[model samples]
Target: MRPRYMLSGNISPPSSAMALYSTPRSDKRTLQRNRRWPGSSATRSSATSTLSRSGSMLSSCLQCRTSTCRRISISERVICLILHSRFSFSKYMSESHLSLRVCYRKIAVDEGGLPSWANSKYRKYTPGKPHPNAIEYLVAVDENFFAFNITWPQDDSKKYDDPEKKLDQMRAYVTYFVEYDKQQLPRSKQPYIFYIDSRWASLKLMELLHENQLFGVLSCGENMRPKVLWSWIKADLAKYDWWSIGLPRLSANLVCVRTKDKVYLKILTNYCALKEIQYKKRKRKFPMTEFYVAACDVQKEYNAFKCKVDQLNKAVLEYFRLSRYLDDKVTFTQFFIHLFTVQSWTYYNACTGRSLSQLEYRVLVLQELAVEILPPPQPSVLAVHWPKHMGGRTHNCQYSPCRNNCTYFCIACEKWGCLKCLEKAHLNG
Candidate 1:
């Protein structure tokens, strides 16, 4: 008897596979063109077409290495499996702005299936060096680490001096967030705040955020703002350790804090006032482990919520690094698989309060998928009875009185057994 694992299903392909493997329109055209004449020997092209049609199912089945997914296209097979298994995990969303911590992070993917046209148009070049071929994705996540708004792969190359062109990619990011926010949290009364770093700060973006009735707490850089104002702020830092200036036209205020060694942190926001609030930080000198408290509401809010997106990025990288599996042929499949894993992990942790680590959760998911979708290995030699590795799976030894788990399957006996069990069952008998 076959050993049951975490999940059980009939050892057959689902009905949905039939729809996926149905003859495509282009294949039908080839059939009409390659029809053999009744009275003449079949042409080479006709024979070729016949062979291809006959081999399609066999090839697809081999590619998946599974009888249950026989004849299903690889892309469709993966997507179908994902969709089918999605019923077990629930989707989660923030209820309102009070609980929502909106932040943005750019996910840089190296050597994926990004289109060449967009790549060339937005490729970045340093003063004396060429940047790598990579696709940059703008991802926005809530406090729960759920990535609600994700952009398609785009080039991150931008001109630092031109704020308009600099935030061209941000347009899509903001649009997606706004649309999703309206649909998911329609009853929430407070405006949504988008937390972004200095690279994304600009007056034009501020206007767009205000237009959408959203707010932002963006870290500002000298190069990202007008030179005159930036210089004024830098010089004025000599007289005062910290100060804020309000821009009446943009309905935003620029706040700068002069830290130890004259290093300054600047923030631009329409939501946060120029009032001070208590916050703690590590000392900036040697033995920096000591904590100190300061009063600044803008810095406090920015520091408290700025790392949500970074945390999400860290989780995606540290837990399941998908870069090694990313290839041009299966880029789409692998990318979505990673995305789904992240979403599932976040939602599971939020809803269940489970103490499972990210790595453990991923392993559990893989085990569940293997039981449901993966097939047993084919026998190399039917005439010979020998044990074969079960592809990292373990089953109870089928030999009577043997209670040990085994990773090897005996072909002739059609049973899972350890080496000792196999030797005793076959050699002794």
Candidate 2:
């Protein structure tokens, strides 16, 4: 026979802590229900006698005494006692029925990985994609200048002390470049394109563009120059004259080889607005804003926004006056040269409204002309110059063109290199 396995414990009512205290009669009812009922007096007495014997056996088992042991095989009685104990123990469980229900509901809802139902309520809705034809092509360019600063030592005794201006100047140059790029590029492109160096600031600008949904192509180092990217854009826009002019113009001056070229400047203006507004008191009592310049290269120039009969005649006369300077029938190069020269003069006059000395005016004109003719100097040519014989044997010469050196050099030139020394040297020669 197989060895019998049974749970060993005294079958007793649950403790006061576990029992249902609110219902005082529950324990009595449980006991009554578990007991056998409606028996003859002799049978009852026999049952009582059996209960007494079983109770004594249970007490002996608790004390680990085996002298008087008894076995009872009533499975129903055991099951009923377990049920009563469970009901009594449940009273001590802390969670209320309502709280348990809520907990189960939460578990059921979160069984899946994500709350897809909540997504509909919390997530933003996006519209359908735009029609291909409705989208417009846009291009933007940003440019900036880089320069260095220099500072001079204040004390004569501290020969080794260097100035702090050079670093400050470089900082300013970079700051200006960043500001110009931000102000110009966004306005120029539809969504906007950003052009910048491979420096940290440039990377930051690109990030800003990306966040704005502005499309742009980044070029590192020398590739970041505006001329290279803008040339292709201008060529593309050449076919659409009106649309080209309507495009925004970047405020940052592009560093282009052809930027100063007469031909390129003309081409650029063809798609850009180059206007010289001259204000004059008019007789008509019109809004001051209405008196502003209304002009375009292709269309007839007029005083008013609309084309009126008398206004058209005046516009025709003005157009003829302006066109006389332009090469209407010349080759592309000659035409561009003429346009570039005339526009340059006009822009100069507008910018410097006051009368200037002949020398000053000539210098300004030459500078403008040179911009078209001269290419940027090579790095070697533009490199900082240091005097080889500055200090006695060229040893410890401070050959690194310090702030004091540059200022001293400029002053020496302006003062004509020490008049007394120059005269003595001349006499010796």
Candidate 3:
């Protein structure tokens, strides 16, 4: 007996050579005119009349020949011929067979009149530079606070994990001011000094200073020993001729000013010696009381400078309010106002009762305020509309995965539809 094998359902062999050879040739005419435009109505009517005559002739020939070949109709032949001529077969059929046509007329506008597409009237505003005499200071402060939990023992494993990130944030905080200084300061003059809190007195910060070549001062907490800080100051002084030391006084902080001015330093330290020399030359006429009155006038001028800062802050806040968008969800205006106020307080603490000269105090106050009111953050997202085929992609589509084949959200129709569907349903009709 012959061996038998089980067969799977619907198992079939591939097509034979004769089957492949005998397959009908694809209509090359169909491929040629896939996207061709339909001819005018008069041309289409003429072609149709010719096709009818050909049909009659073809039918009579087929009846006489009695051939086994499949008959080709006149309508089909005329379609192939029309398509080969590169005229739109589909559009011709729609116009002649279906009886419909659409034509658009262009409109022209005279000079000085706006175009049809003109929409908005308001122009964009560009900001200008502030005055040179304007005082501005860039200030950076960092505070370390311990995290607590209800659990018995502390979770110290996460301590080092956050330091790098925190350091990056602090560095970014100072970078903004550095950019501002570069833009506003003249190339000839040295950059105004940057001020930071004591926690940043790390080797990491020093490395950053060396890398960026920045001139700045680091103010430590009151508990930092004076002798140790003095040693650090002397070492820093050797490298940089200009340095300022902030020390705790009876009620407030005192910043001892020093510079590379050898002549001025000697004159300040030995005023009596200078006076004695001046007496010998018979040039010491003015009493010391006159100098005291002059100093009091300088104090009055400093008070006027403080008033100007207050005025500037108020003006900046008002400008911020004007620029705020009506639909803004964030309280950015209020945030900026609070920021300016905090900056003013820091300036007051750094300068008030610190024996700062009138000119130095004014400069510091203005610099601090400038850094505070550095332009507001730009809008997070912008809306845009682009013409089809312009290579623009929609961001917020109704169909995210596009399983249902929606293209994008339509605000007008309140629905989502693919481009093909939209063209067929709305544009075609």
The residue-by-residue lDDT of candidate 3 on 26-56, one tens digit each, is 2332112111111112111111122121111
State the lDDT of candidate 1 residue by residue for 1-429, as single tens digits.
221110123232234432221222222222121112111322212111221211111101111111221232223333443574442111222233123222222221111122221323333332311224433334555555655434443334442445556565555555544554445533444456778766667777787666666667888777764645555445545422565555544456666776655678888777765444456667657888856555457777777777766566556545333343345445444445666566555544543456678778777767666755887777666747888999889999888799798899977778999999898888889
Top candidate (TM-score): 1
- CA lDDT of each prediction against the hidden true structure: 0.51, 0.23, 0.26
Candidate 2 lands at a TM-score of: 0.14
Query: What are the runs in model 2 whose C-alpha is more than 4 Å off?
Result: 1-302, 305-332, 344-363, 367-429
For model 1 the local lDDT of residue 347 reads: 45
Better of 2 and 3 by TM-score: 3
Q: Considering summed lDDT, which 10 consecutive residues are worst modelled in model 3?
A: 266-275
Question: Residues 1-429, candidate 2, lDDT per residue (tens digit)?
Answer: 110111123222224312211111222221121112112121111111221211111110011101111121122112222243332323333332111110000000000011111212211221221221111111111111100111111112221112121122222222322333344422322232222212211223333333333332222232222324434323422211211111112111111112211322211111112222233333345454334332222121111211222222222123222222333233223422322333223223332344554345446556644664695765654233322223322122122232122211112222222233334434554
